[model samples]
Target: MRSSVILLLVGISLAFAGKHSLKYFYTSVSGDKTFTATGLVDDVQFMYFGINTKKASPKTEWVREIEESDYWKRQTHLLVEQHHWILNTIWTESAGEHTYQITYGCEWNDETGKTNAFRQYGYDGEDFLFLDLKRDEWISPVKQGFRTQERCNNETIRLVHWKNYLKMDCIETLKKLLTLGKSSLEKTVSPQVSLLQKNACSPVLCHVTHFYPSDITVTWMRNGQELKNVKVGKLLPNEDGTFQKTVTLQTEADEWRKNEFSCVVKHQSKTFRKTLTEKEIRTKNKTAAPFDVTVVVVLVAVILSLSLIIGVIGYFVYQRKLKPALSGSASKCWLSFCRISGYVTANTSPSDSENTSQSSTES
Candidate 1:
């Protein structure tokens, strides 16, 4: 039961593992030369070569010819025959989008006779698979894949020698290509900086746009001192393959007018600064006056309306209490008046009869 539960959990975990397209790139760097070969796994389960910029033939022509070559066919057959089970299992079990990259490269040191070579596998940008140079064993993060590869000891041994041979043979071609690419590349471009204000009281934004290499620094300063309340946005890629960034400095209208706030951008060994002046703030405030007036008016109207509603409710509640008290008091007063009148009439009538009898006796 325990074993079954463990296996079930492992299966469920692996079910959500991401599927990835496989891409292999080979680079040889020797002296000033560089050579590269890139292959992508296609939908038909075969490796398709993309570009060999070193070749004289057109890229499409080379891809077409390579597909029909005996080497390509044999390699494809060997890969499918040896690893079809693992590939099929991964394809069936995994889910979502990801790409697996395999980079094989050899760098030949001019002073040293031997080459430094590596074969590494990564998912997205993180490396998780490697080949042991001495043991020729496959190191993988996937438990199942590692276990399966471990069983193929003889094949692993053969692959080690083959990879070593490839590293040695490709180093010369790579060095030449590196030199060619370096010679043709252009110098990096500097970033352009601009100041943007959304409104008078809002944060002042310093936009740095169209920079090459993507490494840049943007900072905000207030009164010649670096400000800490600076918000830097993410580095965004532009449509033209350059990068852009924005840094914002928050300040009140009075503070902005009182102190000199500046946006400083450093890119490609050049520094650019744009300052926020009192004039700009005044202009923005002037433009926003109508909007500010409208907002104030709306707020005052809402407050007045609420006050009127509250006054009406208070008056009604006062009237309700006053009416009940007045009714009770009126009933009490009427009762008191009737009692007093009855007492007075009884006393006065008795007194008058006594006075009349006394007057008749005197007569």
Candidate 2:
């Protein structure tokens, strides 16, 4: 029984290990003459290197800097040179402010002990070249420079070997780090949905915040049809050891105002949906002015009619019974009618009035 309990605990811990990642990012901005780079393990920065051309040579940091010879120095120099070469090759008159980023990462599955390696080079946040080292494949834009099919294939082989080497050398350390960094499983958070308008175009945004275990999907649908022009931002870390992400769908104002849009979020095998209706959108934008005005007029007419009916009933009751019994004057009967009318009007809430108006209109 003790052995079984230990095995179960181990299985649970492995289940919560999530995806382990190691990423290298390089970014250069020509307009600002700044270059920045970092090496991250599971989204935690372990090394940072940067250079501002307006300043001195370069700044460097390695958490394990002392455990090296001049290896990092040489690597940093080569990286800076490579950045300059790529920048020169891709620079254009129209490309005033340009950025280049290279990301290499591996995701490890604790349960399967399987790993997938990825390498991507992007310009201005768009992928120009991508390599799936595990599959030994490459994807590049047609107009990208210095990236040929043969070269990419060759680089893929080298990177695959390098990834294996790193795994063999660092997997144990990385696993320990991941274990230390693992967060407790928190309750799944439902996404918040809203419509945003920019440049006369509206986009529905589903923001999922403060969730655990990183694996979540956000999908947008229009009138029960899935949308293609959807933008999903990267899953980002929160300060409190949770995760957040945003998914946006770009839609035309007419479509947004006429169709039903829904944001569906799936996390931890559970699904949540937030739906926006055309009427709700119209009401939010205050474009249902005519409908609102019509409703108000109908409500007022119903209320006045109700008050008048009640007043007549009261007047008749007073004249027939109360007036004869008390020998009341005409002014007293009028007062009773006025009091009933005032009470009916004063007791009618806006919601009740609206409901009554709608019921009458429907009838």
Candidate 3:
């Protein structure tokens, strides 16, 4: 049991060991000229070498003063001449301004570490570091130039200025290359849903690969709503330093029958929503009816009432002012009645007398 425990501990330790590591190594440089460089490393240390003419190390003795053109082409175990008039040194000299190449490589220490051996050189650059040829109050190369020809020896004092100049130009170029690589990789791991086998129902699998590990998220949206009970798998980086993430949701055959389901991917600050729907979502609006009919009814009643009130007022006025005229008409009617009565009585008397005369004569 104890041996087994020991073995388990060893296994755990090995498992915990990371598969990748990063290291930054910089050498001294001289002058006002600045440079920027970047490189990719796999299980290796990133290193830079500068020149110092005043100081002599085991490697510096072989470093001979050469023409500016010859300086850039010269190559050593760790440093290489990259550009013309550039002399590369793990050290720099101060007599004059010269150019040199900065080479990047991978090195491994042997088990019985005795000698140093550098592997193949993958990349080299001309503007890895800038040197101010003139002396400033901050970093004066004249004092340190005699000891080490390398100017700009005070890295801390000039770091801010040097970093700003190099980072601006170098970062842009570095980002462009990284973007191209990302694009090329995207084409390979792009999700392609295919029906592997078709029986009464077909099962589909979505494959998404070749993505940056830090900027990736996948979710399954059912219908128009996102599914809460989704099963997401772990994301692992690919061998090419990219990433692959996936989400699996086993829905009923009828659920995806019409292909109404969709997958949404979120990366960085952008949210990409994709839906497989027949129509787009829209809002509905309705207008209420107006009060025109009610208004017309009220207006008509008001006008009729107003007219009736005005007519009654006029009738009252006429009754008050024309009373004498009405009495005059009544008196004329009475006069006519009296005249008729008198005429009737006179005619009757005449008739009776005529009748008496006729009877006496006949007797």
Candidate 4:
């Protein structure tokens, strides 16, 4: 489910610049009326809304200072309409309660004027209908979506509205949110870049983890020339909503010894370049930590894990609200991130006034 979300949305952007996206994810379960709407600035989920709660909630501290209650009210109203639309559309088509998801957003390059946007609809874990902004067409892969395609084809105005929304309004909203939360948005955690190999002959994996703002680039360069045959892994979510990614070089270990092969990573303003070398590889045979150091690390990890668990549980108790319980496998949730808090700071609106944003939303 999360991998699907990752395909639909971005890992996330802003103060550090480059590019940014404003996207929304909505899900309606078969028997659940309290569906949630997630609003993300690039990859970071900053706001959430629920049909039951009827409140647009902030997910980050910086967003709490938006000072626009009406903006949130408009967002709540828009999401509410969107929430019902997805549910009713699914129910009408399936002739029964069915779960469905909507992922819609726009991407913008801050340095350049490049912009792109999309709307993808999914039901029962498959693509149902999607808007091809470039082609200005609605694509429905499954037979179940024929009516939807036909309806969308006939509604040229809605298509135009969406085009404008994605191109203009969504981009503007993203920019505003970036400005609103620059201090928090710019906070980044440098990736822990490590070259790991299980054995001398195994695939040499450049593992990057615990990085923030998810816009890191990993390139395999041999003697400063880019290597195209490398296997690049997906950007995966972390336990704390950070990200991890892997780039694999599937060659004999001797290749790096003969050439200066480097794994270069660029994120925000920092760049990490790690050359492949035997001494740098954390091989099982030789790279194991000293016994005492290993024990100390394990003990500290255990203590920290226990402390984090207690702190999380305490947060739930004191807040008196729970959206979704945290699990040990949070890092494994690729895209549909686990909701660990009911308390969030709310922040995006349409390009124009509240009515303008809301008007485009109802479509």
Candidate 4 vs. true structure, TM-score: 0.68
When summed lDDT is taken over every stretch of 10 residues in candidate 2, the lowest stretch is 54-63
lDDT of 1: 0.54
Comparing 1 and 2 on TM-score, the stronger one: 2
lDDT of 1 by residue, 118-196 (tens): 6675654666566665666667766645654565445756676757654644454333322222222123568987676
**Candidate 4 segments whose C-alpha is farther than 4 A from its true place:** 1-16, 31-34, 95-98, 239-241, 284-363
Instruction: Select the stronger candidate by lDDT from 2 and 4.
Output: 4
List where candidate 2 sits over 4 angstroms from the true fold: 1-12, 15-17, 30-33, 41-47, 52-98, 123-126, 132-139, 143-174, 183-204, 220-243, 248-262, 269-271, 275-363
Candidate 2 global CA lDDT score? 0.61
Best by lDDT: 4
lDDT, residue 309, candidate 3: 100
- By TM-score, who's the top model here? 4
**Model 3, residue 257: C-alpha shift (Å):** 2.0
Which residue pairs in candidate 4 collide? 2-335, 11-43, 12-42, 12-43, 58-344, 58-345, 58-346, 59-344, 59-345, 60-345
How far in Å is the alpha carbon of 267 misplaced in model 4? 2.4
Put down candidate 2 lDDT per residue, 206-271, tens digits, no spaces: 677876556777888888888778898998888765678888777665565588788877776367
Give the lowest summed-lDDT range of ten residues in model 4.
337-346
TM-score of each: 0.38, 0.49, 0.23, 0.68
RMSD of each: 23.1, 15.8, 34.7, 25.9
lDDT of 4 by residue, 59-170 (tens): 9887776655576888888888877776676565555556688899988887776888889988878899999987898989999789889999899999999888888777
